[model samples]
Target: MNLNLAVISGDGIGPEVVREARKVLDRIAEKYGHEIHYTDLLMGGASIDVHGVPLTDETIEIAKSSDAVLMGSIGGNAATSPWYKLPADRRPEAGLLKLRKSLGLFANLRPAILYKELQDACPLRKDISDKGFDLMIMRELTGGLYFGARETKEVDGVMTAIDTLTYNENEIRRIARRAFDIAGKRRKKVCSVDKANVLDSSRLWRKVVEEVAKEYPDVELTHMLVDNCAMQLVKDPAQFDVILTENMFGDILSDEASMVTGSIGMLASASLNDSKFGLYEPSGGSAPDIAGQNIANPIATILSAAMMLRYSFDLDKEADAIEQAVSQVLAEGYRTGDIMSEGCKKVGTTEMGDLIAERV
Candidate 1:
């Protein structure tokens, strides 16, 4: 197989972790007899410094032309610097948002898979979190409150802010279709979460999702209020197969879902389009405090490389090899500081990647 990948190593730990992911990919290519080409580009704080913009047109062009994109964490405290004085669209995180929009990546898939070996690392009780929570969250990335209308008004010398929660039928239908498709691939169950009781827009979302549900008769579809879903996630996360929700709900829930696995660094995400290309990334952010430190976890990034192989290149065997390598490494008691527990071998980022790549 031949593959061309765009590497947007955003900032801070982004470059560090992305390098590890690349190493894993190199190992996979060498072992599996595949040719993989990579084009590295700067983004986030680094791009803001060098290009005077968070996301350069050249970077976008590179991503668009590539077969797939692998993005590491973006955003840091450096965003508060004088260079960030540019317009709203020029912000570091805005670059990511733009990339998603430009690519029409409506479906953001975040899988929360808690391995049996890391059960003790979780903060929840042994029965609650340790038993293992394996679920996928299909978040509507390009729609809902995140892309809604906003207004600020001064009424009686008081500033009142209003941000709309809106979703059209087509947007809801596309994401619901994605969720149902993903559910079919996994456990054939879909939990569509919303706040229909209070918000009128959510009612429309519910209506649209229910309408879309008719297209997939074999898939079991259920609706839960966002608040109730949040509670249920902590109570019994395993009950969910594919948790589908709007943009804001997904953003918040996915972050919360990370804790189910004890560390955000363990989570990987894929922002996908209907086209062959997609954006793979870690669900964690750039930890500036530990930027240059070798202690930062690279599992998420490496796992993202696995996702790139499976989703982007259709390299199922290679993807499985990478995943098994990660699982095997974890099962062998290797751990990073964030997900480290007693009796586990704590290692730096490079060592961990080398261990996993060696296994691959």
Candidate 2:
């Protein structure tokens, strides 16, 4: 098998982590007799320095044409300029938003996987967290409040900001279909989370998910209010296989559910559409304070590479091998600073990545 990948090492520690993922990919390529071609592109602050824009047209063209995209974390204080202060299309984060929208990545899958060795790293009690949890949140990426209109003005002597929540039948159907498919592969349980009682948009969301549920009769379907779902995640995360929701709800809940795994640096995410090309990234943001320390964790980025293999290339065996390599590396007690417990050998980012790649 041959794979063409667009590598966007955005900013901060993006390059460091991406280098690790690429080494692992190279190992898989050699072991499986697969040829992998990687094309590097700049984004975020790096692009701003080179092209005076956060995302270049050439980069977008290459990304859309590639088999998959591996994005490192984007952003840094250096990218902030006085002229471009928080404008929707000019902010550092705008580069990412533009890529996702341009590529039409509507379904985001965020997996919170807990390694048994890292159980002591979690804030939750050992007894509850030890049982372990692995769940994915299927987020509807391209819709809802973030894309809605806001009416802010003086109304009867007071200023107010109002944001709308909206969703269409097709959007709900597509994302729900992805959720149901993922549930079928995992544990056959799909929990649709929304706020049906208060919002008309959520009511339509629930109605559409229910309509789509008929197609997957074998999968168990349930509905939970977004508020309750948030609480239930902490109480018992293992109960969920796939928690699907509209854009805003997903945005909030996925972050909340990410904590069940204990370490932010251990989570991976993938954004996809109907096409073969998808954007895979770490759920954690660029920690500028630790950007150059060589101690930042690379597991999330590595796992994102695993997702790119599974979702974009359909290389399930290779993906599982990479995942198992990460698990085995952790089992060997190799630790980065973030998830390190007592008596664990703390290694630099590059060394830790080398250890995982060696295992691969």
Candidate 3:
């Protein structure tokens, strides 16, 4: 198999982590007898420095030509970076938004797994952390309050702002089906979260999801209000296998879920279209503060590459190889600065990548 990937080593620690991911992928290719090809494309602040824009049409065309995109973090210190001074549409994050919209990537999957070795790093109560949790957040992207119409106007002599929140049955059903399909592969349970009690949009979401549930009888389905779901995440996270929710709620919940596991640097995310094509990336930021120090954590990005192998290429064995290598390295007490514990051997970004790659 020849796997072609578009590499977006965006900015800050993006290049560092992306470099490590490529090393792991190279090792995977060597061990699995597959040929891997990479096309490097720039976006975000990196692109801005060279092309004077966050993203270019040329970069988009290159991305479209590839099998999947593997990206590191984008943007920099908002308080000081020149990228943040640009117009909203020209900023680093805007480029990411544009790419997601251009690629028609609507289903965002974020996995939050508390590794047994990192149980001490978990922020939850020891009892709750001891139980551990492995959950996937299936977020419906591209449609919702985030992409809806918005404006400010004077209403009854008062200045008010309004942002529309809308969802069609088609959109809701598609994401629900994706969630249930993924749940079938994992624990066969889907917890659909929404604010159906007050919002009409959420009511429509609940209705459509329930309608979709009938198709997946093998998958057990349940519904929870968004607020209650938030509470439940900390109270009983292990109870959830797959969390299905809309754009706004998912955006918030996924971050909360990441933090509960102790290090966002360990979380991996994917955004897929209706097909197998997807964009894989780390759930953490670029961390401009540690950009050139070689001290950044690359596990999330490497795990993201594993996700690309599983979800995009459908190479389960290859993905498992990478994932197992990561687990083994952690179990051997190898740690990056972010997830470092007292008794663990701390390593730089490159050394961690080398350890996992050697294990693979």
Residue 28 of model 1, lDDT score: 92
lDDT of each: 0.88, 0.88, 0.95
User: Model 3, 1-360: lDDT tens per residue?
Assistant: 999999999999999999999999999998889999999999999999999899999999999889999999899999999888899999999999999999999999999999999998888999999999999999999999999999999999999999999899999988998999899989999999999999998999989999999999999999999999899989989999999999999999998999899878899999998888999999999999999899999999999999999999999999999999999999999999989999899999999999999999
Task: Give per-residue CA lDDT, model 1, range 1-360, as digits (tens).
Answer: 889999998887998899999999999999999998999888877788998788888888888999999988888775565545767778788888888888889999999988888777676788787457789999999877778889999989999999887788888888899899878878999999999999887899899999989999999999999999899888888899999999999998988888867777888999988776889999987887898899999999999989888878888899899999999999999998988888889999999999999999
TM-score to true structure, per model: 0.95, 0.96, 0.99
Between candidates 1 and 3, the lDDT winner: 3
TM-score for candidate 1, residues paired by index = 0.95
In candidate 2, what are the lDDT values of residues 56-85, reduced to their tens digit?
889999999999999998887644544256
RMSD of 3: 0.8
Task: Give the higher-TM-score candidate: 2 or 3.
Answer: 3
Clashing pairs in 3: none
Steric clash count of candidate 3: 0
Predicted model with the maximum TM-score = 3
